[model samples]
Target chain A: MFEKLDPLLHSQLRLAVMSLLVGVKEAEFNYIKEKTGATAGNLSVQLNKLKDADYISITKEIVGSYPRTTCKVLPKGRKAFSEYVNALSSYIHPNGNE
Target chain B: MNDAQKQLEMIHEMMNKSQREFQSASFYYLFWGWLVFISALVHYLLLTQTNFTHPYAVWATMPIAGIISGIYAAKQQKSSKVKTYIDEAIGSLWLIVAFAFFGLIAMAPALGIDKVYPFLILLYGIGTATTGKITGFKLLYISGLLTFPLAVASAYMNFDNQLLVLALAIFISYIIPGHLLKKKELQMANSDA
Candidate 1:
């Protein structure tokens, strides 16, 4: 079941971030950080991982004279998330065990 | 499996173990929409059947419900950028119900203006067109085109079955299309699996 899940989205925090991002058209860095309750360093590391996998696109721009980083899940990310969810459900309620 | 493979499997296990704890906006928005759908259906049924003889009785709830649905839509849009078929149908249905509420209110005035309901239907038609454009729902535009002219004609001629006509328009233009969109979504999800 775990093998079928996307390795990029297999982590708890990163999975949470991508799940939230998929629903939202785009989310701010702080939004993801606040929602996941992860420290800036940890969030940055996970975001870089996702960026490397091409699962999420991150854009840095200035908003109100301040730097902002926003994240959006790509179509591939959405498909991976859905597949991850479907595969995960099999583990939760195992088949042929009962 | 190598040590790295074993570590990856363990991490997957740990993630799955904690998956039950994840919470986010998408869950809440969908949960609220489902609640609204159920409650609104009950409200409509009771108001239409048990309320006073005049249609104005239910009109009071129209604006209130419309505002509520609008707020819900705005909240949902914030979370989900992708235009899913589900939201499109729900939004169209919301507008139709809102317009119907106003139509009933206007029709009850006894001001000898039977055109009020027809005008409301026309408003619903426009709403469908706009929703279709925004959500890329071709069926919505088709439904709008079918209802607009019929609404206009109903206003010009005083027919004995005016109530039946209005009911048919709502059933065909809104209710049927709403169900079809829902079915389409379900089919897509199934095929995806």
Candidate 2:
């Protein structure tokens, strides 16, 4: 009687991104990179996967002379994250104990 | 532990990592507080003590302060990594305040400098209290709301004395709170480190 975790968010790096994003309205690409401790190239690839699933929205704009990219979690992504957490909890504490 | 347990722990770690402490926005309060404090005092001296015909010229510093504030804010925006809902709300509130401030200054000639002090005090209360409430900083909101009566009292006083009232209000609402906020930031940073 275990529900399945959202496979899209089950991976460590992707899950890390979602968890961090759920805590903020929006964060810069560089900020996420620094927080997640993932290489830029790998983070970009993972971010695209989440973006393709409508899990997050990315914005690119020129601030002063630099092109800054920002990412925000969408409602669908938040819901999936919540569900994933529930599934994990259920698996960890089947009888509702530690 | 199982895979599920490992994932759960990772989630907890990531969430904790992203949970941030509040940014110290004490800079705005301190900068504006000192600016208003000095300007009001200078205005009072020029009006009462000096035979200066253009005592009101002291307030021409507003545009310069505005330019400095704009540049500072732009730099803060550029350096900020995460944008929280609180920041967004405070940003919008200050934007409105800026517009209202310039509007009041433009109308000062028509309203008379005597009339402008009270309105400026009212604006300060509105901005401070709203910001305090939004940021969940009790000292800020309390001092901010306390300025309302000060504004009303300033309206009844003469122009020279009104400057004193304005300085007092700025002292309580902005300068004191600004320093306390900065102190809190330092303490938090120390604890975090």
Candidate 3:
């Protein structure tokens, strides 16, 4: 009776990341990590999953001597986020459909 | 029901607790608020009390303010990794205001300096009110809207008196709203920690 929540955003850490990026123009990997409280390795894996799905685009660049990774939510990601929210709302509300 | 509810709860909390969202918004308002206030006061004093040929020269301080703003922006960029929609909207709004400020200044000679404060106050009203409305900060919106009347009042006043009106406008619009925003930011940060 309910649409499926986008599995890519269904997880805690990834949803946290998308929630942040969904509002911002873009965010650095470290910033997302700090906010999500996800270990670098775990966040990297999840981020890559999102990237592969074209939900987000990650750019790695050398700023000064260090590399900076910035992630942006593409149109698909934003659409997916809204869909996820709507699906979740309906799923949780139960009687909303009626 | 259970899992979906948990997920929804998480989304709500994360959005609320987003680290340091628009943290420095208050600082700029406060800084520019006082700066304009002081400049306008000095402008009045010079025009009224002193024999200084160029009362307008006091505005030279803006270049220094510009430098400070640039440095502040760079520091903010360095410290912050996320740029929220509010940040983007406020940033673009002020950028446009900056250009319009210059445009008005360029036209000042044609309009006469006495006539310029009304337009400048109008600009101030636009920047603050728009920023407030978009961000849903009530202090900014109400204070910003209050400046419109001041702008109109300044239009009727003489040159030296216009400076006083301008000073009042800055106090209400920028100084008050900036401080309020700053206080709210600190409170939110404290709650987060």
Candidate 4:
């Protein structure tokens, strides 16, 4: 039997954001946009969704008179991402142990 | 492929891409490496070539250069759009090393200046090796490994000879690796452009 993937992370863009965040301490809004090739509006919406879910934390601060938005994956988010990956692996390789 | 398999691939791809895109400002390494190199050489010269009795005074360069480097690093970090886990880890590691240096300096009077170089070299070794492990850079790992024996050798040498060993260790462990890192950063920046 396959485990259910987290709906929050099932989307292409959301998963991509989580994947990027998983490797970094924190990333700026522009950095994530560049990496994901997603529109700023779309990325902001997805990021907000993750932030609301407590899967990530978003901080807005001024850097050299410019407002910068940085996102970091929370422990909850890391755990969820790992579980999601495990579920995906289980589905892909049913005979293999997670 | 099924959706699950596709998602798995996507995750892997995104992570790999993010890792690849990561770039550090190589200026800091270059700045400190040269500063230390010059300082050590000048210190050695003052101790041997000149009538200068205060060879230790040359170490004043470290604090001055450190202040400048700290300011530059802050500016760079402020401007940077992303900070990686590796960056944070390396930053923390160096912070610890810096404190250790300070602690060693305070204890130098009791431990004697001659005994300090070996411990300082060992700290350099630890810092460089851990940095290599974190970045998966082999040159830095090898440089770090080389410092261990140099540190041991320094223990058996006189102060003047130990200065030369420190100079050689810094050249191998910091300057060379620093230049390579700068080259890598430039290549990454150019490729991005």
Candidate 5:
């Protein structure tokens, strides 16, 4: 039997975002879009999904007359990501239990 | 391969990409390195050759350098979309160095100028070595490691020669590293373009 992966992080764009955030302090929305090659609407929607899951925090602030949306991985998100990786490894080496 | 394994591979790829982008912060290193190099060189020259009463007047360059660096940092921050943990850690480390420098300067009268260079060298070692470890840059690590002996050597020297040693230390630990960082940044930028 394989370990279960977190559905929230199993998607392509969301997983990409999480992977990026895991190593960074925080990142702006535009940066995520640039890195992931996701459309603004798609990235925004995916970010909302992760935010709703309590895996990430989204902050909106005005800087120099521009509204900036920055995203950071929460502790919960880090935990989930760790577990997800563990589960992934299990599947990758399921028969290596010898 | 199953879905989970595929996702894991994707995660690794994305993480690597982000890390690569974060390693291009050569401007800050170059700016401070050159500023300190020039300031220390001039300070040493003034002490040895000029009749200037306060050789310390040369340190006025620090605030001016700080102002230019501040403007550059703010502009970089405004333009940068990504902020990495490594970037934040290095930035915080330098900030602490700045405050510690001010503290040392304030206490210089009591500690005496002869004792100052050793401490400054030690601090440089710590700053550069840790930065090297964080960024996986080997040259920086070597530079940082060299400062330890240099600091110890400066401790036994007279004030004037101590100044010369300090300049030499800065050249190894900062100026060389700064230029290497700039070269790396340019290569990365060109590759990207």
Candidate 6:
């Protein structure tokens, strides 16, 4: 049996954001937007959803008079994402190959 | 798809998306590396061909511009799925700066301007290797290793002609490795899909 994947990150956009965040320490708003090709409105909504789950932490500040929002993957997010990958791998490989 | 299946599919999709982004980033950096080398070569050639001695032209400005562009790329790469760009850029910059420092110091000893070129070549090669290590890119390491003999051989060339060594190093190291990493990343992404 496999562990369940988190529902919050199951959505395409949210999952994309989290997936990108997983490999990084933190990402700025524009950085996420450019990579995912997600509109600001949509990304903002998806990020808020992740924040609600406590999977990611968002910090807002001003850089040269412009607001900068940076998102970081929390410990919970890392654990959940790892478990999710493991659970999914079982489906593809059927057995632990590695 | 059932809820479980749907979630699994979603996860898979995300993984694939991330892979694609990584692939693109690898190629992007590779292109920039080539551009930097080629531009420097042009500068060197112009200096040799014509009567121009803008001290900052080949020596100071080129590498500084390359480093600045690299930093920008890394900052923008913050959103990339695998963080490959930022890692590569950081590693490359670290090695490049170190090499430049040593190369500058070595230039003064009449160690011959010729000997210094090999150091520059090695710096770029090591930079590629470090980038590869950070990103788990096998090709980068291969490129780094391949450049070793070429860098050594270039030591025998005249100082004026040594910039060719820099060009060759970039082609073998950063350019090829960058492309290889991108290819691997794309394959991985497609596999996930």
TM-score top scorer: 4
The CA lDDT at B85 in model 4 is 71
Clashes of each: 0, 0, 0, 1, 0, 0
Candidate-wise lDDT, in order? 0.60, 0.89, 0.87, 0.87, 0.86, 0.69
Tell me the TM-score for chain B of model 4. Answer: 0.94
lDDT of 2 by residue, B75-193 (tens): 88777888777777888898998899889978999989889879999899899999898877999999999999999999999988999999999998999999998898888869756
Deviation in Å, model 6, residue B129 alpha carbon:
5.8
CAPRI tier of model 5 = medium
For candidate 4, list the clashing residue pairs, or say none.
Answer: A25-B85
What's the residue-level lDDT of B60 in candidate 3? Answer: 98
Estimate the lDDT of model 5. 0.86
Worst 10 residues of 5 chain B by lDDT: B20-29
Write model 1 residue lDDT over B1-193, tens digit each, in one string. 2433443454455333333221122332233334433443444455456754544343355457557756766765554324333354545565575667556655756755464657766765666656555555688678767777778778866633344455556555666566666666666558635
Tens-place lDDT digits, model 5, residues B1-193: 4777678878998898788666456676677777777778788889899999898887888898899888988888876778887888888998998888888888889999888878887888889988898888999989999999999999999888887877888888888998898888888879866
Q: Give the alpha carbon lDDT tens digit for every residue of B106-154 in model 3.
A: 9999989878879999999999999888888888999999999999988
Q: What is the lDDT of residue A63 in candidate 3?
A: 74
lDDT of 2 by residue, A1-98 (tens): 78887889978899999988998788999989988889999999999999999999999999979999999999999999999999889998887776
Which ten-residue region of model 1 chain B has the weakest summed lDDT? Answer: B20-29
Please compute DockQ, using alpha carbons, for every candidate against the native two-chain complex. 0.06, 0.66, 0.64, 0.78, 0.72, 0.22
**Model 2 misplaced regions, further than 4 Å:** A1-3, A37-42, A59-69, A82-98, B1-23, B188-193
Rank candidates by TM-score, best first.
4, 5, 3, 2, 6, 1
User: What overall lDDT, based on C-alpha atoms, would model 3 receive against the true structure?
Assistant: 0.87
After superposition, which runs of candidate 3 have C-alpha atoms over 4 Å from their true positions? A62-66, A93-98
Q: What is the C-alpha local distance difference test score of candidate 6?
A: 0.69
User: What are the runs in model 5 whose C-alpha is more than 4 Å off?
Assistant: A95-98
TM-score of chain B of each: 0.52, 0.88, 0.92, 0.94, 0.94, 0.63
After TM-score superposition, the amount by which residue B37's alpha carbon in candidate 3 deviates from its true location, in angstroms, is 1.4
Looking at model 2 chain B, report the run of 10 residues with the lowest lDDT sum: B15-24
DockQ result, candidate 5: 0.72
Residue A52 local lDDT, model 5: 97
